[model samples]
Target: MSDIGPESAAGKRTLRRALLATRNGLTADDVRESAVALAARTLALPEVAGARTVAAYVSVGAEPGTLALLDALRARGVRVLLPALLPDNDLDWGEYAGEGSLARVRHGGRTALSEPAGERLGPDAVTGADVVLLPGLAVDGRGLRLGRGGGSYDRVLARLERAGTRPALLVLLYDGEVVAHVPGEPHDRPVDAVVTPSGTRRFR
Candidate 1:
C-alpha cells in the first residue's frame, strides 16, 4: 500500500515508479483473478453495456488484464477496436477479431504489445467509439488517470475533443491503484469513471 496523496504533489515519474513497482510484485494467479473480476465488473457498467463500439487495449506486463472483457464484448456482437502503436507513439486503430487476430509487436526497446492484426482503421477511427477504455498505471479520486506517459492516449483524447465527440472514458485497475490523487499536467485528461476488480466508481 503506497500513499499517493494529493499533498505529495508527487511528480509523474515518482508516482509511476511506485505504481509500476507495486504492479511488478503481482503474481500470475493474482493477475488472472483480477482480470476475471475486472471483466465482470466492467461489463456491468451501463456505458459498456450500451456501447455499440469500444476502443480498448491489450494488457501487457503486470497491468490489469483485459482479454476477458475484450472477448466478452466481441461475444456480445459489440464491435471491439484495439490499438496499434505507431512510430511517433500515437496509436492506429484496428478491429479485434479475437485472440487469434492479435499480433505480438515489439517497439524498439519497449515491451512487446498485443495488437490487432487486421486492417488498420486509422487513428481517427477512435472518434467513432461509444466508449474508450484506457490503460492506466493509476487513477485518483478525481478520476484523473496516470498513463504510461507515452502521449499516445493524450493524442486520442485531443483528437476526440477536436472532433466534438464525448464518449464515456474509463480506466480499469486494481483497487489499490485508486488513490487520493495523482500528478497531473495541463494536457492530462480526466476519466469519466474507473473500474476495478472490487467495483466501479464514477467521477463525473
Candidate 2:
C-alpha cells in the first residue's frame, strides 16, 4: 500500500508512472472497443439481472462503451444515473439518457456534458443502486483501483460504505493494465470486479 491524496508529490508521481505504463500498452481505438465489449458482457451477468437502476462513471480519455451499455439498459427499462460533480468536489448522481440527450453543464474547472433526463441526487441515492461501474487507469488482483487523481469516486464510495450498503464495484480497464497490485491507501476504494476486453474477473 502507498500513501494517498493529491497533497503528496510522491503519490502523484507514482500515479503518473502507473498511468504512463498502462497507456503505453493501450492504443486509443483498442481500448474503446474493448471497453464497450467488456461492458456488454459484464451487464449480461446475473449480478446485474435485477438492476432496474444503476450508476456509471463518465470516462475522460477513451469513451468506454458506457453509452452503449446504458442504451441497452434503457431499452430493458433500466434507469441509469451519471455523476454530476458538486462545488465541494463530491458526487451527485443524476439520470442519463443516451448520447443525443447530452447538454453542457459546468463546474469549477470541469464542464460535464450530461444527458437530458439528468436529475441530481445526494450520495444516499446511490445505495439503492444495484450496480456501480467505475473508471480506472489501472486495477489490481487485490481490487485496488487507480483512479484519475480526482477523489470523487473515493469520497462517494466511502459515503456508501458508511451507510452499510455494498454496491457491486466494477472497473473498466485495458486488458494489459490488470496487475498483481496497485498502490493503495486508507482513503482509496477498491472494486469487487474488473472487466476488460479479454473478460471479466473477480478481484480477490
> Which candidate's TM-score is highest?
1
Worst 10 residues of 2 by lDDT: 110-119
- Pairs clashing within candidate 2: none
- Summarize candidate 2's per-residue lDDT along 1-204 as a digit string, tens digits: 565665444665576586666675667787677757876787777777678788886565453556667777878888878877777777777777777655667665664545344556766777878888887777877888877677888887888889888778888776777876676777777789888877888865
Q: What are the per-residue Cα lDDT tens digits for candidate 1 across 104-186?
A: 99999999999999999999999999999999989998788988878899999999999999999999999999987787666
**Alpha-carbon deviation at 188 in model 1, angstroms:** 1.1
Per-candidate clashes, comma-separated? 0, 0
Quote model 2's TM-score.
0.84
TM-score of every candidate relative to the true structure: 0.95, 0.84
Give candidate 1's total backbone clashes. 0
Clash-forming residue pairs, model 1? none
| TM-score of candidate 1 against the unseen true structure | 0.95
Top lDDT: which candidate number?
Answer: 1
In model 1, where do residues sit more than 4 Å from their true spots?
A: 1-10
